[model samples]
Target: MRAHLPLRLTRTAAFAAVCVTLAALAHSLGGGTGPDPWAAGVGLAVVFALAMALSGTERSTTTINATLVVTQLGLHELFGGDGSAYVAAHQHGRGLGDALGMLLAHLTATLVTGCWLARGEAALWAMLRRLARRLVLLRPVATAPLPPAAPIAHVRDVPRRLLFRHSVARRGPPLPA
Candidate 1:
């Protein structure tokens, strides 16, 4: 069964909040002063939610971490500026310290978000399993025993004339011999 709407929404909100927070932290640490684009954050959140919903709930921790890393990088760039500005800044040689700071922030965010999501995934599956078990247990049971069937007559016990008489009925009249 698919996840409920409330659960999906909560998961999406959590993901978006973590991404935005991490992006803001990384930007500030990298000496950025501009505000992040709210539109970008909302767009990314919608995309992320759709992807997660389509991908199903039983994702591995590694997969979650990898996705988080990609999202963090994308958000960092989006927050820093548009794609072109980020590329230009990188080409101009950002300091190693700034690079390390951003890396550390992204890494930390990935680890934390991955763990949180992994735990939630496990719990959801476990709950679903328990619910299924309970449903099975609650199924209606047949309490009454079935009636016994009639006994069959052996072919050898019946007379041959009686069988022939029963086989062909005298409808109207017998055919002319």
Candidate 2:
């Protein structure tokens, strides 16, 4: 058990290190004022997903994916994110808040896509289910089967007179030819 603990910790650290390295590379490459904020996020996400997939262990994949997410979040926060250009262009040299917001949005998309690619839908759904079960607000609804779809009751027949047809013109006197 003690040996397992060290291994787990090492695995976690390795994952975090990989994420930080990738983040650094991304920052160096395109994390600048002129570059699109999504470029680094997408590049890191793709690389992390491939790495996690190649690891060949579900637990390791999940653990690594989570570590990458948290590490990326911290890095984004620490470095003021990669949206300076956008903020400068739109807000005109605004405060760090907008940059942080952009960082959050980018990281969220990156992490979600990375997790999905690494763990697949089943794993994500299971995690969501577990979270739902644990949350007090969702506990009751988590196990509840979806209510049967409402039956489509037939509408009452409409009176024929109520319907209008262009072919049924009034039988008034014929117009002069």
Candidate 3:
């Protein structure tokens, strides 16, 4: 879907396609009540964009992601989450708080996912830097000295002058009467 986008429109168009796909899937799986048809995915995308914009203006992504994750966890626990008894009791419950919680959860997950992906990219960049240092083409031009190589040794017998004496005769043997 994003492949058709020009170099400039590429990112926007891809996100638009994602929003459309998300809306269609959500509607189908949610039995027409999952979320609003045009609003589900696109809304979240907007939320993500907003989150990114907010981060640019205010806090960092890590802080935002952490805040979202904690909020979502609280909401899930409150709603009788995953398989909890409390969540089961509120399966049909409705309130302003619940609505707000749902909104927060969706936004949090989206932003947190984006943050983690950016982090993954950062790690990849660091690895690429290390790799560049190893490759001759990408390595920095430096005049520094190289490290020493491994040493080699050979064993040889020493002459008598260099060796300790093992002889029984002395220099005075010829002069003895």
Write model 2 residue lDDT over 113-175, tens digit each, in one string: 456545553464477567766786744554667899999999999767545654566788989
lDDT string, candidate 3, 1-177, tens digits: 012213224334433344334434433442323434444444546545543433322234565455445433432333232434333343335677876765565565547564764464355446756676669676668888978976867769856763556646545546656
- Residue 146 miss distance in model 2 (angstroms): 59
Q: lDDT at 93 for candidate 1?
A: 53
The best candidate by lDDT is 1
lDDT head-to-head 1 vs 3, winner: 1
lDDT by residue (tens digit), candidate 1, 20-68: 6666665665544544568465646754675456444566778767777
Worst 10 residues of 3 by lDDT: 1-10
Clashing pairs in 3: 79-87, 80-86, 80-87
| lDDT for each candidate structure | 0.66, 0.53, 0.45
Scored by lDDT, model 2 comes in at: 0.53
Per-candidate TM-scores read 0.60, 0.32, 0.32
Query: How badly does each model clash, as a count of residue pairs?
Result: 0, 0, 3
Clashing pairs in 1: none
